[model samples]
Target: MLKPRMIEEKMLILLRQGKISKWFSGIGQEAISVGVTKAMQEDEYILPMHRNLGVFTSRNIPLYRLFSQWQGKASGFTKGRDRSFHFGTQEYKIVGMISHLGPQLGVADGIALAHKLKNEKKLSAVFTGEGGTSEGDFHEALNIAAVWDLPVLFCIENNGYGLSTPTIEQYRCKDLADRGPGYGIESHIIDGNNIIEVFEKISELAQSIRNEPRPILIEFKTFRMRGHEEASGTKYVPEELMEEWGDKDPIINFENYLLQEGILNEEKIKGFRKSIKKEIDENLHKAFSENIIESDTSQEIADVYETYDHQEIISKSNKENIRFVDAISQALKQSLERHYDLVFMGQDIADYGGVFKITEGFMGEFGKDRVRNTPICESAVVGTAMGLSIKGMKAMVEMQFSDFVSSGFNPIVNYLAKVKYRWDQKADVVIRMPCGGGVGAGPFHSQTNEAWFTKVPGLKVIYPAFPYDAKGLLNTAFNDPNPVLFFEHKALYRSVRQDVPVDYYTLPFGKSSRIKEGEQISIITYGAGVHWALDTLEEMNFAGADLLDLRSLQPLDLEGICASVNKTGKAIILTEDSLAGSFASEIAALISEHCFESLDAPVLRVGSLETPIPFAQTLEREYLPKERFKNKLQELIEY
Candidate 1:
């Protein structure tokens, strides 16, 4: 192995020579990245940190493209939206690069989970700085990865500090790798500067993880060679630090040993550097020639995602129809049949057909290749699904329970939802959040978070009330070239049954479904709430009370709300989501402005109380729709 001292010096030459600009040099810590990357299979992925340029050589990412990215060029993946060091590629299986603390772990979990579910014989190698292990997402990803037995190699390059903060100030542990066992993950510690040791241990660790679904936390004890980046000054080091760390330079030490063993001669070492320098110069020239991604590489190659022929799945009956969940299942079936690249996944979605059995018989019909089951790892499932979507595979992923979505929020909100704006990359991903609260699953299982994601732009959130709407909305979701968070209410999964149209159809999104039109109160709700309000209104002949089922949440049909309220002189917003900052609150505020003159009273908002849900049925029933509240609705109608 060439000493990291040589590699680090050569990298500095590349940077100063402008072969690559703004390099993150692992001056004192080259062994870990280089050793582990070299030990791993050439085809396997290893998403390293900025300092892991040595690993890039092992992974075969052209130095020119890497430099192009750092310089903020379209020729590289930064695509202008990403910082040079914070991006990854699909073709290369680098998965993703996020400069944010611990974001790469989630992507690693995603890639690993996808391989496990799809039965792909591959692994996802994810690296992080030791300091990042303290981040919340790191812990979350590790826990889920361990539980699901994901083939994830989490390399924590313990380079002493996170920018200015020392590791001791952040972590109380002697070795961060020890934290892995609590999550049932296998872990180890290595002298980061020792190439042979790092290479051997990492090779064994990766093979172990790939053979069995488990996470390996390898802590590499090393030091940064320079400041975090070129702009940051490295003058802060103590005087003794230079001599002490310099004596242990892995690159220099390794080169001496290799020469002593005749594995490398001085002439061979010089020739290697000469060849590498030439390669770096050539890569830079190639990167400089290609146009940056600002003008739409995705658009130019847009025809690839155009596998579907756009067959409209229109509903014949808007008056009477099927349960929303059934419609969703039928539409999913149609999408699978129509789109050859489409795939479906969820916990128990295959053998058990999901907890609600919405996907019953799907595994048998589509086979394991298209329909599959996954371990209970939402982030991994969602992350993997987004990756496949990015690769032009249409994915319909489901959360066994909507409440579990928070487990996967980072990828859904930060990555899948914004990948397009970030890289101008289209994520044809549909995440089905099974929500609504009627079930007695308690706080852990009964929460509604569609409103949470509805606030985020770039995500299409839909909450269909009827079966027909579910089918149509799902079809529409599949067609949309953006990320869609499709809400499948567990409460409404089998609550209603109606004969849906045999013909495939999808309802137009961003539109409200007027279940009933009246001159009285404009009752606005969606999902299960749409049924609750309609059932209540029909029992007593509030014949003039119009019921509006808002199918979509993100691109909310506020215009419909204003128009209905303006005529009725009253607006009532309902949701199973908590009252404060809930969907109802937004509707109330929207009505307050858009239909202010039309209000009979401050827009009445009905929803669960601002407390964690109770498992007991009686307490839950009394918790939200208190007797006084139900009576108040009746009193308002009588008035």
Candidate 2:
């Protein structure tokens, strides 16, 4: 009864004191949180949403740390880079908490799947608000969880509003819990205001879900007495909402139950409130007055981000490396052979071998138990990877097309990206994405958006054009301590295949490969589009178009790029992604800043024009930097 009020009071205090910049409230929504947490085992895993402050506190996220995070203190989780609402403690087995509405469901599924595969007893519980239940990701997560029968408990806190949109407007269904049974999951609706009822119901549901190896959904019928956060207001809320829900306030209702059940006397209850208020006030002050950390933390953070460097030749057959896809296929083959803790998942990745056929023969090599095929739910695929990655397994997921990468954006950024850095945990995860624009594949299928991932710190972005590079990069990603998104150019999958080295070796990330060097112009690029830039140089009769393959995009070889620019005196940056704020933009800026005086023609940029890439095959080439390439030789000769 006191958990929600105390936390809300603390949040309000911190907000007014300017100690907490952001805080989500579960004031009237407490019983459900406290109930589920009470039902969950001390060591079982949980992925919480922002509103479940009571659950988090029970899970051992100290109020001060949470408060300090909200206050934007340096000591906060995410090194103060993340939001106050994002609270997690790996030591306590709270996998993570994300601000994204329903994505955690997928994350939980992944972990449960991994745990079950490894024969571990741990289960995963994910919490989300009523509003978040309607997303495609929500349905995706539930479907996978049911199919796998992963021991996961999904608790929905139906506070009636998905922000300002009411439940009636959000879904046509009468009960969110009812939808779970359709997915072969057991479910129940609980009176969230009644702590005893909630606790018992949650325990029963959690046991069933965990024991059956299937999921169970608990629709927590609660009300929000406070606003969404300390930042937002209740102005949009109707008067009748406040009036009708007043009787359903968990705190007030729970307190009455405690009194009726003789669990607490009036005087003792009053004393408890007073004590909680004082504790909250003191905690807020402490959270504010705590010491700060400086910027050198990332160096140590980077230092700690090391895994056991495990690179070994599994078989001559495994790695007399062949095609780019061969490296992927062999890597999966070797990964499956070497470690039973590995799982391969994605759309068409099982038997059909993915849309690019990258996972060909995987179903035969590793049976359904290990190499699982998924529905076309990229968000679910990645989210499940997050879960498995948490449970001490290496999960290699395939995103059918790089363009569809946006579907699982939340898990990639919030769950997969931040898990290790934020909670001091590990996510040995890799996402294989077929990327780049070329071969007249049209706009939807062809787009290189690695730049969207490049700016994201902690994630390693690998783009390999040849079979050898693919083999090396896959090794690097598998060995990497953090999450890695390995971008395989679909055009290059069958288009190019160099006989790779027999030895198990890895090309270090952030290094550039110079295919050829020339003095006239340095054609700096990555992926399949770079091939065109190279071809253009020859077609235009430029004797010197220095082609440097940017194999690693995130840890860009600035020194290499600088050296090339200094030698060539002219440069042209080409990329197939959108023109604005693209990788080309970054490279151009880097050259201008470092090798500015050496520039001959304002550093020519050959990239897709600043517009949505059109669908027509002929128009696609036209949209790219043809003039920069067409006039390359002429421009160089003039220079």
Candidate 3:
């Protein structure tokens, strides 16, 4: 406790000196971090918040490396890509917290779920502030953890203020732990300032959790002695309250007790402080001398996604015609059979098979452990997948509809998308999105939101039009060590059919398939737009057209797109998403930039009207780009 307190004090000095970028001081609340971390086993993972510097120190992370991390040096855990405790280190068995405080709780639940699935006697501990308890992720994580009886220590460091807001405004309950009973979880409240009390209680609870494998919520009642961050001063805090909490300082109280008990003397304390100061100074000096990270676009791009050796997939002589939905089910079954660590999770996916019946008999075939049903908690479920990925297990999450992705957006865009680039952690999770319109599902259920994910880095967006591509690309997505959003069009689930290979086959991403070839114009599209373009060309008997289906959007087939565009000299990009800020616009920009000299006419784009999809069939037709695409193609050919 004293060691981390001293380290934090030194960091503050460095922060004021402009040596380090920022610091979240855990000065008065050291006992909670120190005590909880010390109680956990070396192998048990702990997901820590920014203020929990003692957790890292207690876990024995090298002082030099941590100093380097704060200094944004090349030797840092995140290679200087992230700052403060915004990065995680797998080597130390510590998953660092993202800026969003509540999400890590769900991540902790995932790690615990992995342990339970492996039948291991391990548990995961996660920290959050009292204010973070208000987030929906908090309730979702607690509820899911209780439902699954996962081995997790849900630690809430109830520091009096959340930024500037006091506990009075944060919650209605007297204590944060009181809410645990509502989730059917065992709850406790402890004196976070007392190191001995915090240590003994946490140790007991952790052991019980490992033995019983259930979630427990423990609130460490403490106060933050410093501001939220170094820059945010404590002027908002009342002087009396600060003085009262300052008098109850954990380190001073512990020191006083040690002195009275003859465990430490003034001279011994001074010597200890002197030794710690020297250690911190030496490590800081070393960190200061370390080279700053230099920008390398090539290396930065390479690090965004993990590389995989593409292998040619051999197909069996026998093939069977199947619906797009069946192809997806077959792919998942094959993947589950191949990878023991792979787990499938979604709402009503177990016995119910799923809303689209994608996993019809998955539970009976793979058992409940592999094929699991989750509550309607998108944030927690997505976060759990991330945690499982961190544990070296692959997870498949089915968002019932792509529209609901907004609920799970934080974990997907913030954590899973940036995990590999931040700390070289592979987020081996695939989100199955049943998207698109033409059905009467309306705007809430049917949305072509692939462009939203495609714009984000560190995410693979796969939108397949055919059953073969759906199955083949899914296999590729499962094999890739990154997060993939596999968009399955709900409208084409039953309408589309193809003689897919009976044997397991993989397709490489960033490769486009030429459905038909011509020289006059190129019709480039993906997802439902591919079908519309094919029909339009066939209807017009347009022999002078090139039809291309881009299977993957992130690792996009730029070479294939440029080849067709350069050959045809005229192209039309079509998509189901709206025109403004559409992926079609991005494709047009790329074509114009790469094929300017080859172009005989300006590249045209066809997309849905900038309006929410309606329920009526006629209105939906008008809203989509099907008819517009045909007209646009003819206009391009004429031009």
Q: What are the clash counts of all predictions, listed in order?
A: 18, 8, 0
Models sorted by lDDT, best on top: 3, 2, 1
lDDT by residue (tens digit), candidate 2, 426-514 = 77788888876656777677777788888776677888777777777787777776788899887777777677766566667888999
Better of 1 and 2 by TM-score: 2
Per-model TM against the reference: 0.75, 0.89, 0.99
Query: Which segments of candidate 2 are over 4 A away from where they belong?
Result: 17-19, 230-244, 251-263, 266-285, 292-321, 418-427, 533-545, 608-630
Judged by whole-model lDDT over C-alpha atoms, candidate 1 comes out at: 0.74
Clashes of 2: 8
lDDT tens string, model 3, 319-409? 9999999999989999999899999999999999999998998899999999999999999999999999989899999999999999999
What residue pairs are clashing in model 2? 19-71, 110-384, 110-387, 110-388, 111-387, 111-388, 149-213, 348-354
Cα displacement (Å) at residue 474, model 3: 0.6
Candidate with top TM-score is 3
* lDDT winner, 1 or 3: 3
Say which prediction, candidate 1 or candidate 3, comes out ahead on TM-score: 3
Give the winner by TM-score: 2 or 3.
Answer: 3
